[model samples]
Target chain A: MRVGELSRRSGVPIPTIKYYLREGLLAPGVATAANQADYTEEHVRRLKLIRALIDVGRVSVAGAREVIDALSADGRDPLDLLGEAQYAIAPRHRPGRESPEWPAARERVVALVEARGWLVHPDSDVIDLVADALSAGDRLGVAEFFHNLEGYADAAVQVAAMEVRSVLARPDPAAQMELVVLGTVLGEALFSALRMLAHQHESARQLGFSPPTPADHGVNPAP
Target chain B: MRVGELSRRSGVPIPTIKYYLREGLLAPGVATAANQADYTEEHVRRLKLIRALIDVGRVSVAGAREVIDALSADGRDPLDLLGEAQYAIAPRHRPGRESPEWPAARERVVALVEARGWLVHPDSDVIDLVADALSAGDRLGVAEFFHNLEGYADAAVQVAAMEVRSVLARPDPAAQMELVVLGTVLGEALFSALRMLAHQHESARQLGFSPPTPADHGVNPAP
Candidate 1:
């Protein structure tokens, strides 16, 4: 169909469609004329996935791009595809460079990390991760910080493994897939919000402070 | 004390400390001479916070900078400070442009969201969110994706609220802060990994696939 027809058929607006073309998020329709272009069913499907990632998953464009590329890669079965998608969204220490002087302080932190025996890679990424956190009030000593994080990572690994094992233990295939769909799609957001709440409450307890009020919008307020 | 002494005291190494200084993640120790510099207690504390954020929280250097600045903002209460930190670590979408060529497809997804009466903001962000997801193999015509995500978000909100309420219900401030650290530091990693497993197992069931042998990790060897 022509652009207008494509818009009508797809329910996306014209100007917005133009923007997608510019962003490389969408390819332009076939040129029927100098000013006209045609779209296809594939376009409709693609547009929907993009929307799902952005609107529901709340991933950024760069993040979403990575995810889409992963999905397009071979070896993904339908049942496992969603699971892979979840991995792409999994949280990790985002890495970037810091000022040169930051490394002196970083080494101190790294030693503490090593002494504590946390399973972290000693990459430049670690430097980027630690460089910006220097100013928070609840500053941890090197020993204390590494010890705390290692404990936390260990606890997390155990809990997550248990939950997943339980989910997979069920016998019914339909239920299993439903669980996967439900679990992968919603599980990250659910637990992420939960963790934030847990953190705030726990931090408050350690600091001898009051736990803050919940957002009450059915959404856990950040922190 | 000298920078070397401060490094020993803080557990930060000299080389890494130098990097932190160059990155602005730390202030320069007071220079005693061309070859010597003195450091102070504040440096030690700041180094710890930086380590926690980078090493534990896994924040990027640029992101950590933003987070630290927010945490250090004068006059903000600790609760508010933490809230800001949570959101900063993972910012939510604002809005973005949509495409006209896929109006029908966009509308299908939007309508699915609207039918649920979701309070989605229509803007460039939302548009890009939808557009990028197109590559994820989600069928635009299928309503299941929207329904699934909405349901999941709802459940997540409820679970999170419960967790927070339970923690806050505690009578002691010390206990509350401890919970905060526990949840944030530990809970985030734990739940995320579980969610990933859930996706993998569930997807296999949905696709009529059998589990691999014990020797085989969940991932296919070919993959």
Candidate 2:
């Protein structure tokens, strides 16, 4: 198929496809002539995946590149694909003073995470990462809050892992790989949006607040 | 009090306090001399809130600024705060593709969302946004997978909204607000992780596959 047909079929435009090819986001099509290139089913599939990462998953071009690389990596475990992608996009920390209470709080989190059977790498920064979030909390009712959150993260890890693996079990490697990305990437945004709404509604009922109006941000503002 | 003392009191470090002031993330302390500034309780409170945004909320400085502006906006309703924050972080759209199917899909979604009693904007984009996701999903065995997801999103919105407003109903508005940010932001991550695992597990059973190995992002070659 010509690039035009590829664009029409994949819904990705010619210019964006050109950019993706130049940026190594997509591999080059076979050159039938000096200015003609032929695409294939794989191209269509890859293009759709790229579209999914960008449009639905909200990943940056760089982030999407990393995800696609991991996804298509030969013999790469899905778990590692997810991890590599996460590590790449993980927020960079500004080095600073560590709180004296940080270690103890970290221990508490470690214990909680372990008890919940999460696979925390021996050197995974998530321990310190979470502890920093806790310490940064400064007794603003976050210690207990994190305590609950740690448990939630544990349960979440289990649930998401299971869901993704189930999809990976599909006989079609294509579908399996497709779900792997969906369950991990786009799935995050979907559930995040859901959790935000869920927590808000629950909080409203318990707090006896009036039905939500448009002006709440003025009173509550972003944290 | 000195910055060190305020650090101890607020659980924010001296350097972070400096960073905050320099960034205008926090208001400056009362000036005692050319090189001296005295910290106050307001500094303590602001410091904690900033930490919440950075660490627990995992919001970037620019995003934090948006939240802060909304929060500081005088005479705004709380509901607006939530909506505005969502707007800031709402999903992005593609450059051009007028697929009529998206609006129809979105209408179904809106009906589902409204049935759950969410305060949704009467905008059409949300439909397009969701249709994009469903369209990208080629492997979700069920034809009405988008509808299923809408149900999920609707339920999530209701639950999250309730949970958040419950905090606002607390006796202390500050604590309520703090918890709201913590719950919504952190809860977003946790819930998504859970959904990922759950969906994987269900998909596996239906596909007749073995359970996935434990969650390790970096590991052995694919099994």
Candidate 3:
């Protein structure tokens, strides 16, 4: 297939596909003629992953490139693989003006992870990411959210263990790395959406809202 | 307190505060004289919430205003409150080009929710959100992610129940609304960061990497 076929197959516009090519998000196709390149099925697949990262994960093109790069990188040291995967999951935070609440919030994060016996490096940018979110909650006058930290951590640890097991089960090393990106980026989107629905469900259950039935979704029960 | 004092206390600059005020994200302070206005403690807290939504949650100014409006709206019917809170969590998705996989994925979502016995409306945008994410995973050629949907939904249900309980425990109706915003936006951020750290910890444990010691974080473990 050429660019048009790739675009049609992938449902990405030609110009945007060209843009992704220019941004190195999609690997170059083999040159066939003047101003023409032959794309394979892989190009179509990569385009979808790029859109998933940009549209769903809100990751920058640069971040997407990093993830794509890590996806192909196999047989690396586990620590190095973890380093790149973490970077892809949460892009490094830019330096910003520090709030007065930052230190205490950061300490709370460090303390929580320590209490959980997590073996992540202290220098992982995720520490600051958690701290930043904690302080943002504090600043919003919703410090009550902080009380739920242990619960969140417990759930995360359980979910992460399951995720790691799933990824490790992939037979191929490249497939393993690909699952890392999927489980990190799309996984969050899926989780966030489900969490929203779950919240609505819980609120309804607790507040006496009637349960939605098969009729609500066009499913008819037998008479 | 005047606008200047409001800026000082809130740590938001006067210009940005004026921008937020003009955007209707912050309510207008009491006009005491020409070219001056007296703000209140409520203004300071609102400023923090506004920044949290914009800076941390990446909500647009208009969306922040909607959330702020919902925060002050009390004693509404539970369904109405849930409607408004759901909007606060997810700014409505704009219509976009649909992929071929959309219908099947949407059906899968409906089936999952129905199986869970949730009481949410069929028209909730979150259904489309989950569908979009699922199809994005399909497009990315990671259909293996679909297998984990049940697990993700499981965690979401448990976590959402805990969150709703926490929100309901708030004595004030308005406080309950505030917790909804905090739990939705900041809660996702907190979860994402923790999930990343957990992934790293799990990867290291499963891959036989050595754990970081107290010295790694400058805490000396007492022998």
Candidate 4:
């Protein structure tokens, strides 16, 4: 298929596909003739993955490229490649003097890790992210929320264990890589949306606001 | 304090502060002269909140203004205010024909909600978000992960319930609003980071890989 067909098939615009080709984010298609090339199914799949990373994960083009490269690397440990890919696309989090309570927040994170007997790197960027988020909670006057970290950690580890097991069950390395990317990015999205809905339910329950069923509200049944 | 001091105090630029004022996202300072206005500590707090919404939450100026206004509305229900604010900052997700598997995915989400006995509105945008994300998984060849939605829902509800409780416990409506916004945005970040760490631990445990200790790895001790 030509670039036009690839765009039509993948829902990406022709110019954007051309730009990706020019930037070497997408591999060169087979040169069928001068100034024309034939793309295959792999190109369509790659294009979709690229869009997912950039549009959904909000990763920069360069960051997406790096993640793609990491995924494509041969004969490497799956765990390392996945870690690098997940870290590459993760939002950068930095704690500063603005959150004076960050020190206690950091201790809480450390304590949670120790209590959980988890095998995570002591200095991982995620530690700082978790600490910083808790620190921000303190800054915002939700100091009581810190006491619930154990509950959050329990749920996180439970769901994450399930996700990891699914990724490892993939028959091929390529499938495993796809699962890692999707689970890391889209899984967070899935869980966040669920949390939002859950919060809505909890809020309604606490306030005695009955949820209007779709049948009563004339809401569309299909999404 | 003036705009310059507000900038220095909140780490927002003077021009950006003026821009927020011009856009009515931030309340204007008291006029002391034609060219000067006095800002209070409330201005400093409001500036930080604005930055948190824009910078951390990645909310548009217009969206932030709506959320701020909703927060300030007198005699309104906190539950409704929080729902509006969270829904406002949430990333817009529209499922399209490209995700052909969305119908089945939507059914799975409906089933999960029913099974959990959750009281969320049946037609909430989050229902579509969860369906769309799951549909993407189906498109990407990770259909087996859908079977794990129950576990994910379990965790989401557990944490979200705690968060809503914390918000409701706030002594003032203003504090309740702050917790709602902060919990919705930073809480997601916090949980995502925690999930990433949990994935790392699970991967390491499954592969028999030892997590590097900070002391031996020369990792920074402080975040």
Candidate 5:
């Protein structure tokens, strides 16, 4: 298939596909003539994955490249590959400050980790994220948000355990790495969305408001 | 007592403070004289909140203005104000495509809600989010990711219930509104970081790798 068919099938524009080819995000198709190349099913699959990462996962082109490289790298530990993908997509945290509240917030995070008895690297990216959020919560005078950390952690660990278990069930290392990346990135989006819905439901119940149903949207039932 | 003092105290630059002032995100300090205005403790507090929203919550200036307005609005129901904040911060989902997978994904979300006995509106922003994620997961060929939706939903509802209970405990409507906005935005970041840590711990245990401890980073122990 030519780039035109690939673009049509993948819902990506030909120029974007050519750009991806230029950027080495997509492999070159076999040259059938001087000005034409033939793409295969593998190219189609790769293009879809690239589109998914950029569009749905919101990963940068460089990040997507790193992810694709990790997926294709051979002889690397699956765990390390997963780490690379996770680190690539993880949100960058601002550097820590020397403010008094900063230290207190760091202490709170350490306390929560100890109480939870979870083994995580002290300098892990998550440590910074947790500390930053706690510090911001303190500054905002939202003590109650921090109070719910334990409940949130409890729920977090449950989902995390499930994710690890499911990903490990895959016997193929490459498949495992792909699942880890996709699950970690897209899964966050999914969980955040679900959390929002849950909030809506709980708030509606508390406020005595009936939530809109599918019927309200005219979503027809299956006949 | 002045804008300069407010800047010094809040660690936000004067120009940025002025920008916020221009944007109506921060209320003006009382005018003491021509070209001189006296800022109060309220100004300092509001400045800190604005910084936190911009830095940690990643709320845009416009979004922050909406949030602040929601907070200061008079005689509005606290829940309604919270709804505004949540809506403002809710992650925008891409419009659904007219494809078989899209409708099937929507049906999956609807079924999940019914099975869980959740009271969320079918037309809620979260519905599109869940459906879109499911469709993406399906397209990415990761069936196991969707398999864990039930667990994610269970955990989400627990956290959401705790959030509602905590916010409702605040008697002041403005404070309640503030908590809702802060929690809805920053809380997602916090939970996501925690989830990453949890994943690391669970994966390390499964893979028989020892995770780095606080001692590895020379983090001082509490005396």
Candidate 6:
């Protein structure tokens, strides 16, 4: 296949495909002539993955490049590869002047990790994320949100365990790595949507509204 | 207090605070004179909330305005206010041309909601979110990811229930609405970070690596 067919089949514009190629996000096609190149089914597959990462997964182009590089790199441990994907997708945080609340937040995070007996890198972006949320909660006077932490952690661990099991079951390392990356990225979106739906259900119930039956169209009034 | 003191107290720069003021993300300060405005402690509080929503919660300027407006709207039902906040923060999706897989994905979501006896609106953003994720998983050939859906839903419902209980416990409608907005936004970040940490711990355990103790520094040896 040529770039034109690749673009048509992948639903990506030719210019975008060319940009991806130039950005090292897509592997270079075989140079068939001075102005043309022949792509393979693998290229089609790679293009789709790139679209999924950037479009659906909402990863930045640079992040997608790192992820693709990590995916293509052979002989790396699966766990390390997973770490690289996590690092790549993790939101970048600007360093801020140390605040009065950070120490307490850090201590709380450390205590939570220790209490759970979960081993994670001390420098993991998650550490900063957890601390940031805690600090923000404290400042906003919503510290009660942390009261739900234990429950959230329990659910988080269960989902994480299931994900690790699924990833480990894959025989091919490349396939396993791809799953780790996509699963981590898209999985967040999935969980978020589900959580919102669950909130709607729970809020309705708490407010004494009955569940809406299928018969209820546009306006789902409480029965 | 005045705008300058409010800026100093909130750690938000004066110009940015002015921008937020201009954007209607923050309420106007009481006009004491033609050129000067007097801001109250309430102004300080509102400024912090705006910062948390925009900076930490990552809500857009327009979205933040909707949220603040929702909070300030008197005599609105708490549940309705929460719905507004959720809508403000919901990821906007562009409608796509109908595809073959969408029917199946939509069916799966509908069935999941029915089975769970959830009363969510049929046209809820969350429905699209779930369907999109399902379609993306199918295209990515990771359909097995749905095998974890039940577990994920269980966890999601638990967290959602906790959030609702906390919101309902708040006596003030405005405060309750503020929490709903901040909780939905910041809570997502908190959960994602926790999930990553949990994944790290689970992956380490599955790979036969021992848990890291606090004393163990830099080099976490792979066993």
For candidate 2, write residues A127-186 as lDDT tens digits. Answer: 555555555443555544444554455445444544454555467665666556655555
Winner on lDDT (3 vs 6): 6
lDDT of candidate 4 over A1-223, digit per residue (tens): 9999999888899999999998888999999999999999999989988887876677889888888888788888766787788778886545353566887888788777866667766677677778877877667555676667888888888988898888888888897887788678888878988899888778877766654564553221222
lDDT of 2 by residue, B100-169 (tens): 4445545655565556655444452334454444444433232222334644564455445445544555
lDDT of each: 0.48, 0.57, 0.77, 0.78, 0.77, 0.80
Worst 10 residues of 1 chain B by lDDT: B135-144
DockQ score of each predicted structure, in the order shown:
0.11, 0.26, 0.56, 0.53, 0.49, 0.63
- Candidate 4 per-residue lDDT, tens place, B40-84, comes to 988887877777776667678888888888887888866567668
Top candidate (lDDT): 6
User: Roughly what TM-score does model 5 have, to 2 decimal places?
Assistant: 0.86
Query: What lDDT tens digits, residue by residue, belong to model 5 across residues B1-223?
Result: 9888888988889999889888888888889999888888888777877777777766678878777887788998554665677666654447335656888888889888777656665666668777888888877778677797889899989988898888888997766776787788778878887888788778876876654454463222223
Residue A150 CA displacement from its true place in model 2, Å = 7.7
| DockQ of predicted model 2 | 0.26
Q: In model 1, what lDDT does residue A32 have?
A: 83
TM agreement with the true structure for every prediction: 0.48, 0.70, 0.90, 0.89, 0.86, 0.93
Q: What is the lDDT of candidate 2?
A: 0.57
**Residue B68 of model 1, lDDT score:** 57
- Candidate RMSDs in order: 11.3, 6.5, 4.1, 4.4, 5.1, 2.3
Candidate 5 docking band: medium
Q: Is the docking of candidate 6 incorrect, acceptable, medium or high quality?
A: medium
Candidate 6: residue A129 lDDT (0-100): 75
Backbone clashes in model 3, listed as residue pairs:
none
Deviating ranges (above 4 Å) for candidate 3? A72-75, A89-97, A210-223, B72-74, B91-97, B210-223
Give the lDDT of residue B210 in candidate 4.
Answer: 58
- Report how far residue B209 has shifted in candidate 2, in Å: 10
Look at candidate 4 and give me any clashing residue pairs.
none
Each model's chain A TM-score: 0.42, 0.75, 0.86, 0.88, 0.82, 0.90
